[model samples]
Target: MNSHLPTEKQQKLKQLIVIFCILLITLLFAFTLLIAEPTQELSSFELDQQGQKVGSGPTEFRIHNQQLYVAVPSNGHYVIPEADLKTIRMLSDDIATRQIAVDQKHVYCGNMILKNLNPQTVRSIGDGYISDGQVSYYCSQITERNTELNVVQEVWQILLHHTGIGSKPQSYWYPHYQLETSQSPYQLTVQGTVSNGEYTYFRGKLVEQANGHTMRYLPSYSGSSDRLRESSHYTADGTHVYYKNQRVPVQDHPQLMVFDFGGGIESEFLHDRKTQNFYYQTSPFSQKYSPYHLLNKDDEHAHDPLFLSQQGIYFYHRQEQKLQRTGDNPFSQKLTQLAPDVFHNGQDTYYLGLYDKYIRSGRGTKLCYRSTVLYRLKNAPVNRWQKIAEVKYGNSRWRAATIWKNGAQYYYFDEFGQGQGFDQAVYLIKDAYALRFILNPSRSSDDIRQYAGRGILLSPQVERLAKAKYDENFCVSELWSQNE
Candidate 1:
């Protein structure tokens, strides 16, 4: 035991070694804490459907209950889109007012209302470009198209000026793409790959793949262009696929089946029909919808392109995104298009949604209504329209033969009758789902006629369009976290 004892220097060296070891360990642990990012909580990555981290990179994003915040490379900040949320890039802050209107519906732009304007009757001979008796509204501005004087080759939002087809078709603004075009849209062949003269255009711009000799624009899969194929949706060269205006690398296998959302001008829901893959401007895999379509079209389960699937008559939900199954859609069966967003369903005429002020499609509760009496218009300004019988909602037992309109018609359907027996009826109008009927003006106004129109009195004020209310059946994000 006495020999085992170390010398004075040996004892000092041993103590130094022990202390060095402790300090090394402490330094290593401190360095690890610094490098590992003590603040990181696994939320730096965009989450998958299972709430698991999917991918991580320098890209910035914010995940919250109501929004999927993403960093805009241009602005370098995460911001929420105005409405569609899908096409955040193309949409301006005021794009909320860029809506498609049904007949007799008001056109709201920002804070102003373009009264007496009808989009379906534009002289441009297209659904969007209409010339109503009220006023003319082109895509961008209140410009007029001389369809009688010139033939429109294409109509794009970007194309400001055109030389007309009668003029030399060499260099003119293509109306469809809204892009200046040396090649006519009518001559650009079915495949977006067609090169006129030497250049090819897509998405209101030129295709970089255009080599003047071989500009490819056909899918390797089996299909032809639909009537709406003029827009640059899923176009492929022999090598790569282009979606929305960018190149989809060969690995993505875009040939499977292309699904487009909204329209050619505003394509937000670009996805694969087979794989249910979704895409955005920066990330190829932005979101996903359900893989299968249960209801054909009217069946409602999975037929709409905007990612809105019907669970019931009104209950709608998005398969993988933030939007959940919202209950209630008034219109059922094969809905006919009386105007852009207005549908003529079996016997009811209902507003498509609540966001007329905003251009969103799949949100807001719809109005479902029915009237027994009807008269198909014989000499009405617009053809093929049948006005339904009006029903009042206020403190009156007589619910039929009158509608709520502004200072123009004979009767006012007291729309918001609280505890007035017609509370349910009033709720429909108060909720912006009022079913209004028209009076047969040619008929007589007798004093004894109480159920019938006594005279053409000025219309009374009705309820205003309701604010957008999207009541979800079940929130997926909240449910997922709770289960975890």
Candidate 2:
């Protein structure tokens, strides 16, 4: 009797309660999804003692122990670790708008800070340099600052004049000048670097003995007009000329000549008009010997002028830097020219001459021309003397003065025809047939003399390829052989 069916009002209230509970549960599920954290599929990594991630991330940085690391996030999944940090400092609360952060002791850009730099006075001076009140930094290395150091004003003007406002100076260092600096720890970009009235610098290092006020780029010795040419390799500071930073002893800057005879020609030379001295610009010659005197400017002259030093008489090759002493002087008042280039010293006979060959390209292929000197002793085996090559045609004959015939080969001397006691001529032809038959028995003397009477015709290619065999030592032979 007490338990009876509920009335209509009670039943409605129960239905309402059930509906409210369902709505609350649905809202709770939606809220959980909205606040869910984004999970990235990262490679397995360890945490440092401070509970910070060990690797580098674009958004996150970590420094543990002495080594610092940067994390670059990859495709939103993992991070690659790399570091080019210079100095370390405890970071501050907020990153500056330039992404540069500052702590009490230092200023930092990402993971790096300048070494031993005071952050209070750090300011951007123009050029590819940063500066404090005292010293300047180029590529992060300290270059001594002089009182006359005035890079800031000029750079600012250049920025306003050339690059317009709001542009950075570092962007213009390399492209505007196309500087090709030598290998240096500081990554120098500016051509010839920045100079003050009293000091000059290159590749972030000071140029010794350089007068920055009058410093200028020298023209190319190879006849290039471009003074700003990166390969010109010469600069002068009013009083002296510097080649690739090394000072040339000769102080006549205006009279200094640096010539690059392309190919194997002459190993490039530096001529000093003031002293009338010629120097080899390349190594070995420049490194070892003093400027030498070249006698007989005539290329046709057969005898290499005696390289007479106070020490003794020396023998040197046309294309080599080495010199050898003959111990005894061969020249005497009685010395006689028996033939066109043949000499007789009463007891000994001498043959002296010149030959032509092609200079090689950077690819190791023949591309240019050079004249080589030929010297030898021709007392025995005259029959073996052969005319392997000759200069028959073109202005090269007179311009180079390279005539060819037969004599002893270059074997007695070194590859460069340098040594003592030239006994047998190697690969030279007798220039004058009348004198040739006097010693050579194999050839029909009558026929050679007859041919000589008619006069000989020689071609340029004949001299070029005749003595042009490249040896293992990179020396070209003085005469053409059948193997060539």
Candidate No. with top lDDT: 2
**Residue 454 lDDT (model 1):** 27
Worst 10 residues of 1 by lDDT: 294-303
Q: Which ten residues in a row have the lowest lDDT in candidate 2?
A: 459-468
Per-prediction TM-score to the true structure, in the order listed = 0.25, 0.31
Which prediction has the highest TM-score against the true structure?
2
Model 1 Cα displacement at 132 (Å)? 46
RMSD of each: 24.2, 26.6
lDDT to native, each model: 0.32, 0.39
Taking the tens digit of each residue's C-alpha lDDT, what string does model 1 give over 341-436? 233345544322221111223776432221111112211222334433444334445433334332222223322221122211111222121221
For all candidates, the clash counts are: 23, 18
lDDT of 2 by residue, 224-316 (tens): 122323234556667876665567666746776654433233434455666545554433233233434432222223234333333333444
